[model samples]
Target: MSSSLLRRLSVGLAALTGLLGTSLIGIRAADAVTVPILVADVDSGKVIYAQAPTDPWYPASITKLMTTYVALDLVRQGKVSLDSMITISAAAAAEPPSKMGFKPGTQLTLDNALKIIMVKSANDIAYAIGENLGGSIDTFAAMMNETAVRIGMRDSHWYNPNGLPDPRQWTSARDMAVLARALIRDFPDSHDLFSISAIQFGRAVMPNHNGLLGRYPGTDGMKTGFICSGGFNVVATATRNGRRIVTIVMGQPSPRERDVKTADLFDYAFGQSAGWTSPTLEALPASALPAPPDMRPFVCGGKKPPAIEDGPGALSAPGSAAQLIGGSAANSPALALAAFSNPALRARSLPPRAPLQPIAVWIGRNPAEGQQILESQEAEQKAAAANTRAAKLEAAKAKRLAALEAAKQAREARAERAQAAREAAKEAAKTTAKPAPKLAAKAGRPLPHAASAYTAVETPSMPEAKPGKGLSKPAAKATAHKPAPAKAAPAKESTGKSAAKKPAAKKAAAEE
Candidate 1:
């Protein structure tokens, strides 16, 4: 690398290292020395000079920069016009200090509210502004966190509508510097609200808290802050010869020390060379801060509002711009009505203990008829349930009857099979019991014992077989033999003749 280029690179690195190390210094005493300071290049948005810039300290009133940013956005969208009236609630009037003493039921336009907020540092007005824009103080704090995320303000959190002494409500000087840059870029036309030195609201004179407006050369406006914990802190911005710079000093003993430290920053920034060596800080360039897309319908007082005249710094309500800018419609819906619930709705007009019925939905002429209708519906539902149970019971009874009948039929078939087997066994036993005759063994004389076995063995009469191709018919007597008279009669009658007739025929044939 060339010698000149290397020299430039080294200088840039040093500048970046110094900027990174800048932090707020914690003061042990209210009158401590070695106060904090930081000077940044506005065009490039880089810190040219810094001392104790990153130190942890309280923000006090300088926290209003973010408040102003949020309010200015509402103005740009026309949801809040400059002359629009804001009614003061009793709660808003109850805030502690740095306030506008508007009586209950008193009204002030948004135009004057911004002035009071900037100059007098009114706490109640800040809360009211937040409540108007964000519905309530708690919800407004959430919006603050969301805004911080969107703007890439990485290290800031908010807890209240006004910057009170919650540990959660702290921010860094560098973070404030980034906010100042955003205020100029985001709300350029409305940005002038920050530079106002004095504003008159009903004979009360309010002067701005920032000390740089008239004292420093080319210094217009920004903001300042103080707290017992933070000591004194200021975020000041100035322009000279078309170059602007923002300086932040936190944790000074007195207000006077904070201003002096900030002036030193300006001197060092103006003296520094134009070119930067650090790629991170050098890359930052001035561009239009993104306008919050608005999707709310333009309307006022129960009528379609007239088309708003577009200003040079025309801001689309969150929805309308998003549609044109390829932004997500799902994020911010089109609000045809008011964005928030009316605070007046929460305001009670009646006393706490009034005779009221919570259960009744609406009052009507015939209350008794309505009650009867409800009773009838209830009765119908009960009847339907009862009918369902009865039907189920009937179905179960039919199923049980079918099972019982099937079991009875099965038992009858088993009994018939058992009786048939028993009859066959009895017939086989009678045939086996008959003694077999033995042939005469003694040539001409039959042995008594052997003859007895062989003597005319009356073979047990076997049941007659049916006349089929393979089986011989049983003896004629076997056919006539009956186990019982009633059992044989049916067979004999079907065979062709009665037993008595057969016997008489046989006797007649013998006489012939």
Candidate 2:
């Protein structure tokens, strides 16, 4: 063979190799862009289609469904009532955009809060609810986790009540399917909160983030979520012919992709019948799921054209399936009504959402009757406490009065005893003051007795008195004579001594 022929063949083979390499690169790029998707029967919990359904992915605002679920549970348990007002703290008000921008101290009833959250996907409102019902965000998160476990959401963990971009806030499509089913089954009364197309707050009317509500046929209710890391996610529900279905699409490249994909999943599920044999959501294996992919760079900083733009008022008619089911050029009610005129779309479009008669909420206004109820409770407590204190004081006063009465009786008894002792002492003193009777003479000197002295005086008076003298006069005279004789005897003794002294004086003189 000629060398030139060999060179020509080599060049052709090189061109073929280059083309094959380019085609393989394109195929790899397409395959690498997989996302989590799942569709299930709302009533039976059976999976209709699954694509990496157990792979972990950031839940984004879809976490609010769990937040809503926990809130509804608390409401059912009477821990929080629909009319209960939740105050907005600074932390809750400070959350990033896609929020209500309510100032700290804003107050909203549980019912109003849920409506705003569902319609606006307001981050601040979600935070406020978690803080209010859980008493703190952390506690609310615990409740979310407990409820998730109870409902068999095995591959989900919650870091915040609002599905903010936390590295740890992850969930799987299968787990979300479990949650969506649980929300419908457990709290049927709250089902209306999710289907509301728009809510009016003061002068502002905020439409729901779930685009399917007004556009997709049979789209009844559910929620949507997004963060940079988890491009855009949606957990949507639709009903047809009395059969309900749930579809979950996570980590889509754009909101349009998420919505379109969800619509496709719903279409596929509704078209099936009883002969399908896919496993139920619970029967699917959930082990060894992949870690959530970080789409932050692609979502936030990419220069490439978006696969689908989800700008406001940019709702062009989607693919044939969407057109067949009443796809509209824009997400307006008028467009939705116009699109519904097609016979093919009429049976699929959800009935017009009921006008929202939202419970009143405010940023700084008084909480109305809720505050009054709280104040009344406090006042009653204070009054009860005061009554208890007064009762205690009255009891103490009664006890003191009894003590004083007993003391008074003791003093009176002591006084009586002292008086009796004094009387006895006086009697003893009188007895002792009486002179002892003179004992009969037992010694040489006779004791002077009143009777002996009377007898002696009487005998002396008898000798001198006449026989006929009266005894009374004789006794008086005798008493006077006894004293006179005693005095005369002393005088006579002195006179005799003087006589003897004179004789002795004369004899002494002769002797000298």
Candidate 3:
């Protein structure tokens, strides 16, 4: 063969080799990732790509999508309004975080609550919404299951409104894609709720966890979920050139992986020729759906799968690899043909993420009414706080009064004791100050006398005539009587001496 012919043959062989290698890589990549994934056309209900689509897996917070559907259905039926209030119950408030953390009896309008549920993935709000719409969580779950069956979700079950961990709660990627399609079809008016990137309430701003909403070009709305047993999952939708696609990726190793995989799927689906078709979602066989896999061992048990990326010379997509090969060889004809023919094979530049404009929803109230209610709630809270403060102050005042009264009684008691002590001392001193009893002198010897029994008397003096009368016969007696006068005079002198001694004795007793 001529040299030119040989060159052409070599080029053809290289292209073939590159194509085969790329196909093998894709197959290997698909098998290496055990996670369930599905991409479908929203308009025709045709599935573009599928891997274990019917396999059972934990739903996690994605269960809120169903909860939202049921709620929106109730709204359609006129059973509830967007502005209707949903009173948070203890059960709802008690749900785990990724929650609103509102207390029981805290009220939020359904409109605003739905925004929180979509953006925050608030478990508590989801439960509260279920209760509000269905009268109880159990009833709401029943409603969810009923709707799921009606919508042709054969491999799904719901045990709670929020997608919290529950062994009985599970769903398949195919089912989620079905639900996503139905949501767009059945509730086009409320479809924008899923597209919200963030919501604001007062100072708190909750951003949606659906990374694809902004990172992936053409992405509009959907949901994301994660739990140890469920791994990371997402149901994403995008619109490009008037054509829309829905993709579900479950059991991803990380949020980044899920987002990249979803973006790649969108690029692949959108780039396909109009004539390309696959099995309709409804016509897909469901013979041997796999049992739900427990991802806890791989996700939470610290055993992680190896990272997989398309090799150089392989097709690339947005948010993933740029080119299969690097350096000068990247411009090879075979690679260029593959990348140009297949959008997924080419690198893409996504635009900067647009600022999120969340739809505003409030409890059974318009914006004005909601504002009024908020102000009223604030006023009530302030009033309750003021009342509590007043009560505390009253109690403190009463305590102080009681203490003062107790102190006054103690002082009175102490004063009474002191007064009693003073009286006792005075009585003791009076007894101590009294005089002692006196003794009498008799015949030059001291004698003790009983004062109560003794009395003193005076004797009349005998005259000197008694001595003259004793000189005659009778006078002789008279003279004898004169001697009696001498005796009487001595008695008088003794009486005078006794009177002087009495004063001296009394003075000595007083001194004692």
Candidate 4:
């Protein structure tokens, strides 16, 4: 009786287990998030582990990798030296935060700009780098795309230098690995540029955004990026013994998660046999997705997915450790997932970072020179302002003087006109006065012929003439009108005898 019942129970349990397993697989397939990951050997370019590596995704601030690349390339071309000064323009300054907040016209060497971007991930500085290097953001972006193609990045299109949000700008995990490898192989001297612990710009000290920089062993340098649309992203590099590896992680929900996930992958990658047969970054085929899937909904949506015991790539990479160890489908895409990810290890906090080694970056060629140039510029501006003010004052003063001069001239003219009028009026009063005959009558006497002489010389219809001092001839004429008791009367009385009688009278008077 016990055997029959036990067999029946066993059969029932087997059917139920198969059904549940199938349902779980379907749920995973439908609900799993798309996280593009890639791990590659720095020198060989052989991909040790990759997951959706070729699927397009937003690069976020990680776009600065291309920016730094373009700038360094220009330096390599000998077009611009590291010491060449670049300016923070208005457009660059206008960019939103994660910035240096330097004012427009602030000047700094390209070297400083590169350092600030790597450590601070400053959007403004990155934009300035693009503008300065490429003559504009668009041209720099063109350079980025060109270089992407040249570097064998098959799935990337860059529209901006700083990986700010733009639908047109996207890169695949495989492409990012290709870029990272290019940056390393192309410019070995710039190794410190990516892994700087912190940058001291004036008084402010900005730490690098890459959490793994100091927390993880053998971590050297690289980059990290994020936007709501593109979750926390990173292109990281680490060197152990003599080998370096590049790991690209995209679409993590938070900084903690990104760091944890990346650390997990690094562990899994380092554990795998380095010589195992694997696809190269270029060998990984591209995803057929037409567009980059937007991560904002899942990342920034009001409700985050509930935390589970396993982290990213946990479910997808099942039992592949045993398979990979035996070299079954080793070249095929499989999870680099650790054989078992203990909850303690996955959730463990990273160790405290080492003391920051901050590099001093300054404006212009040197701090002193930059200060001097700024001072000189400021002085020149002040002088110009003073000159402008002086010019305005001079113009106003000239205008006031001109008005006064005009007023003075007008007053002088008026005075002259008034004096002339007064003179004319006095003359007119004399001319229009009562005739001289009335003056004689008023004097109780008559001046013989005076009225006729005065009337003959002056007329009411004529403008009066001044009593000029040099009018002696006209005065004599006036006096000539005085009657001499009739000279002709005396002549008639004495008759012809006057001449002889007058002579005799004069001789007799002389004798007496």
Against the hidden reference, what TM-scores do the models get?
Answer: 0.48, 0.56, 0.60, 0.61
lDDT per residue for candidate 3 within 1-512, as digits (tens), equals: 78966665565454334323443433322222235678888988888777667767778888888998988888999999987889989998887777766768878888788888888888889889998899988999999999999998988989889887777788988899899999999999987888898887655666788888877887888888887667678999999889999989886545665675567667666655335457877766662533465555444444443221111111111111111222211113233223223333233334466787755544335666757767887899999999999999999999999999999999999999999999999999988896775333344332234421232322222334554353224533443333211112343565565575576555533543
User: What is residue 189's positional error in candidate 4, in angstroms?
Assistant: 1.0
Candidate closer to the true structure by lDDT (higher is better), 2 or 4: 4
RMSD of each candidate relative to the true structure: 25.5, 25.2, 16.6, 21.4
Deviation of model 1 at 158, angstroms: 0.8
Top candidate when judged by lDDT against the true structure: 4
Kindly list the per-residue Cα lDDT of model 1 for residues 135-188, writing each as its tens digit: 888887887778766775655677766565555566665567778888888877
- Worst 10-residue lDDT window, candidate 2: 316-325
Error (Å) of candidate 3 at residue 87 is 1.5
Higher-lDDT candidate among 2 and 3?
3
lDDT of 4 by residue, 211-235 (tens): 9988999999788887756667889
lDDT: the better of candidates 1 and 4: 4
For residue 148, what is the lDDT in candidate 1? 68
Q: Which ten residues in a row have the lowest lDDT in candidate 4?
A: 316-325
Query: How do the residues 374-478 of candidate 2 rate in per-residue lDDT, one tens digit apiece?
Result: 466569889999999999999999999999999999999999999999999999998889678743444444435443332222123223445786445545454
lDDT of each: 0.55, 0.67, 0.68, 0.70
Considering summed lDDT, which 10 consecutive residues are worst modelled in model 1? 308-317
Each model's total of backbone clashes: 19, 2, 27, 0
Identify the candidate with maximal TM-score: 4
The lDDT-based order of candidates, best leading, equals 4, 3, 2, 1
lDDT of 2: 0.67
Question: What would the C-alpha RMSD of candidate 2 be, to one decimal place?
Answer: 25.2
Backbone clashes counted, model 1: 19
